[model samples]
Target: MIFVLGMINAFAANPAPPSPVGRTRPPPPPPGLPIDENILTMMLVALLFGIYIIYNFKIKQKTPM
Candidate 1:
């Protein structure tokens, strides 16, 4: 049947599977934060800013309405 022939054709299309030895593997990433220093610095700044805002809110709340 045409279906059987189509299946055979599809299977035959890739005659040779690539062996692992045929291609080079990607180099391993360095051991450390995957992020850049600029990003890390920005994150730390944001954290400090958040803490500062929270502290200010707490102080205002304690002053009584």
Candidate 2:
């Protein structure tokens, strides 16, 4: 799920095409982490939540009613 979402986001951030007023190629993007912190934090929360849900399901099967 994340991989798909990431690919979508990558495609969404596409920069403008090269301009005739300047160089033929767009300047390289600024350095540092490619994604925003909030995006990573959200992905982490989603992954952890999935684990939590699966853990609960497994624990329920081992417990008495």
Candidate 3:
């Protein structure tokens, strides 16, 4: 299908490059707000909540009048 071919082309065009051959350290977060595991957890929870709301809306729309 055209969609499948497009996806393949997209992936081929944006292939991830290999990492540099040297010692690497993670960059520090911004000064104001520190990005830590807690922030990541909250973001994940918010994302899941958004998905749940959208799913509920779709289910309600599908029910018989």
lDDT of each: 0.84, 0.87, 0.84
Off by over 4 Å in 2: 1-37, 62-65
lDDT of 3 by residue, 1-65 (tens): 99999988998896676676663875567698566849888999999999999999998886668
Ranking by TM-score: 1, 3, 2
Compare the candidates by lDDT and give the number of the best one. Answer: 2
**TM-scores for all candidates?**
0.39, 0.38, 0.38
Work out how many backbone clashes candidate 1 has.
0
lDDT of 1 by residue, 1-57 (tens): 999999999988966856767578865788886557599789999999999999999
lDDT of 2 by residue, 1-65 (tens): 99999999999997997666957777778987756758988999999999999999998886668
Distance (Å) between predicted and true CA of 60, model 1?
0.1
Task: Kindly give the number of clashing pairs for every candidate.
Answer: 0, 0, 0
Please give me the total number of clashing residue pairs in predicted model 3. 0
Which is better, 1 or 3, measured by TM-score?
Answer: 1
lDDT of 2 at 19: 65
Q: Which candidate is the best by TM-score?
A: 1
The superposed Cα distance between candidate 3 and the true structure at residue 21, in angstroms, equals 54
What are the clashing pairs of model 2?
Answer: none
lDDT of 2 at 10: 92
